[model samples]
Target: MGIGARALRQRVRTAESEDWDFSEGRIFGSMCTQPAPAAVAAARRFVTSNLGNPGLAPGTARLEEEVVAVLLDLFHGPAFGAGGWVLSGGTEANITALWMARNASRKREVVLPESAHFSFVKAIDLLGLEPRWVPLDDQGRASLEDARKAIGPRTAAVVAIAGSTELGAVDPIPALAELARAHGVPLHVDAAFGGFVLPWAGPAAASVPFDLAVPGVTSLAVDPHKMGMAPVPAGVLLVRHREMARSIAVASPYLSSPQTTGLLGTRASSAVAATYAALMGLGHRGYASNVRRVLDLTAQLLAGGRALGLRPAVEPTMNIVAFLHRNPVAVQTWMLERGWDVSSVSAPSSLRFVVMPHATRGTVAALLRDLGSALRRFPP
Candidate 1:
């Protein structure tokens, strides 16, 4: 309104316009690709079969309850005072968790590692709570000592990341739990990646527990959309204690579904049905194997990186791999020209990769080749 209206309106119209192929984005980000190893036929069948009937009735509600129960068992909340809600995606799940932790504890400050998903910061901002920043170790794992320094009476809760977004670092949950216990604060785990992989990681560790099964983990946010390989907009927040989730449970009888917890609105049972089908589709062994494959790829590529003289940021134990190049901008451009999409990451100056389900040995080999060539040609 302040400037030339005609030019501004035309410029705005142009900016909003583009022929973006929706499926192209999913081509690389096929988190749901594992659900249907052959194709999405099986996953699609599950969605169509359940949602084709239409309308959110009592049957749909049961389906929602079933998915929640399965996730609760998966995340070690079943035995404790476990409860959860089916969510649209990682953001909603995180938002719900932050809100719950704030309201339940009635405190002004929450502690989280610097490497946590950005949503935690966003959630804190939106919810108007102070986040006490915890630094990470050399390996990117959040430091318990740093978190301990940040906590006191005003510390409402401690949020630990099971699988960090940039580097896939798993903070020491048991240590953080001890800190939370000393202060009588609830501990929340954001396992957006590790939730699906923890069960697999635990067995190979040849010993102890994985997640909330650890005594101190009171709640977790598991994104079905990320590791569960469900369709987009699928995530679940599991609280070890149902009373903890009580903060988000609205009691409006006039709306009809008084028992439900989460953002008050029409629930999408379709995503839940897809998630249930995906979990059942893989079973435990298949998922474990898949996790190992990505980990193996991570190792292989990290080795390749070392061979090529690219300094890796952390020794990866999960799908994400990050490293600093001598000249990152040029390296990224050269790599993109050759094909393959890599992302720039903060916290450490580096390129980050999600070794998704599609990345095979051959694929990794090709990527490594490009990486080596880029390093050789890198500007000093």
Candidate 2:
């Protein structure tokens, strides 16, 4: 007395249809986009593989290793002694990095900027560590002078952001690294959104040092699922030295691997395969092309907003753009009513737009039309 596979498929499709499709390009609020076709196909092929027990899925484990190696190289980590793992996402990666820092230093305080991602809040709470919050400057970047004041004997780590969540602000990582080095504390860079985009973002981004190549950076987190066009739940954590990761390893007697380094025990290997596929298929030139395309679209969005008499909170450093709005909540509601999904930020009271890969010229034009209408209705 059970429904057959055909009926189940039909019912699932019917339910899924009610959700917003990224292909339609109305999902302006999300960091994720429609995954690359090659990545999706690769994921389906390895759906049954589990990387947690490497003994069981050796092929998938090797793929994960290759993915990590490529990402480390991209971040300019040392070729041989560096270590990395593919975790669930940025939150887990951030927590794991902080946990390692706390354990290694045996300290309780973490120095971070106000613009850091909310994931740091969870990490601090879970690890029983105190946070020394640094204020942001007029440009929304973390104040370097304040950060120097915050670092002290009890500081376990210094957290810098390469790409912040709400404002897409890239903190001055090289200077922060110098500060952390002076204090003898690990500096962790959360580059979840910018890691992939910044590498190919042309000359402006080239001058910023936000990776392991910078002297004092100990660990860094980047998400392949964000700008890499990979499936969700694919985050990479790269450490400057392999021994730094040893602080968090726990023995797993039941699993094929002697120890598990990440928070999850049964991780989906499909994500690993998809990440590898996306990285290999796109290569350097392909990603550079994609980044240029999105950045161009971002410029269009900014110009369109300016034409509507709306000003941006800050000049965008990445694909994410935000406009200063008097009534952000009302504008968000108005857009939602018209089937356009966008987000709002509280710090500067702005409406946010993330131009992911799914967003095209046509979609951006449509969104601007609707946004203009919303602005007129709300008079923001």
Candidate 3:
């Protein structure tokens, strides 16, 4: 016998009780965060609407167009031409961009930074393209010299990261763009994390330039669900020229639309509406304020870590801070025991904290207190 709605809801809640306590503000291991109120409301309004076939669902398609236009403006690209589409977060966006590169170029090799997101590796494997990995410089950015050495006759594309997963490093995007342009190769910037935060980072924006303003940037990917605080699975991949996207397009005969722009046949237009609402609601000033606060919290956390004798893996340019500890596993266990959510990095044997909107100052201070106590018990 099937259970009633109330009973089913109760059972689901009981199962979800084991999850992290978002209300207590202890979680700091990932980019995921609670959606903004405006975005949530927008999603609720359009959750049942699908824009899979723009010709059939004209109204939903219009919402998607507005979302894309807003995103292009945010990324410093042209609002006209609508040279991009919303997809299912970073993985799909990255794969889609790589697929375009693979088809557009004669060569089958992609040169990427060692610090590039793992999604690129997945794309390389899936697309049957060779990976020419370039090492990072001392500052944890893709080394221009290394990139120059790595790219050769078979180099189809060069990939750069704006916000690296582990270190939160911003590659020298303009330099990479220059190199790619000179070699007649396409440059794709994976700014999924930084794309939403970096534009309004105030003085910090001077150091990071992974955007459409850079002349040689052929394509770019961004995730509205990350820093934009939109609902999940709202990623966008943009091409500088419309022809680049058309090169990888497939014919879709059955649908009202003649061609399919993305890998999936059916897509949630609710995500696009929510993303558009987020961008419009937050505006430039709102995001700048949010990013500024996160930066302050990050500084406080870094100071607290240093006080406990923890060494930072890199000087963070973004909200993510990774620090080296003697025993990361033990630290993680101790934090978990105290009801404080924390995570560790494998390569540097370190702990990482991502400062999001939920990680308030008071919660961060409490985290520091807990870390101090944990360190005293398990010293580095």
Best by TM-score: 2
Error of 3 at 94 (Å): 0.6
Candidates ranked by lDDT, best first? 2, 3, 1
lDDT tens digits, residues 303-379, model 3?
98898888899998889999887688898899989887788887667898998878898999999999899889888
Which of the numbered candidates is closest to the native, going by highest lDDT?
2
Error of 1 at 114 (Å): 0.6
Candidates arranged by TM-score, highest first: 2, 3, 1
Choose 1 or 2, whichever is better by TM-score: 2
Whole-structure CA lDDT of model 3: 0.85
Task: Give per-residue lDDT, candidate 3, residue 151.
Answer: 90
Q: How would you encode candidate 2's per-residue C-alpha lDDT over 93-185 as one tens digit per residue?
A: 899999999999999999999998889999999999999999999778999999989999999999999888888899999999999999999
RMSD of 2: 1.2
lDDT of 1 by residue, 270-299 (tens): 676667777777878778888888778778
CA RMSD (A), model 3: 1.6
- Clash pairs for candidate 2: none
The regions of model 3 sitting more than 4 angstroms off are 79-82
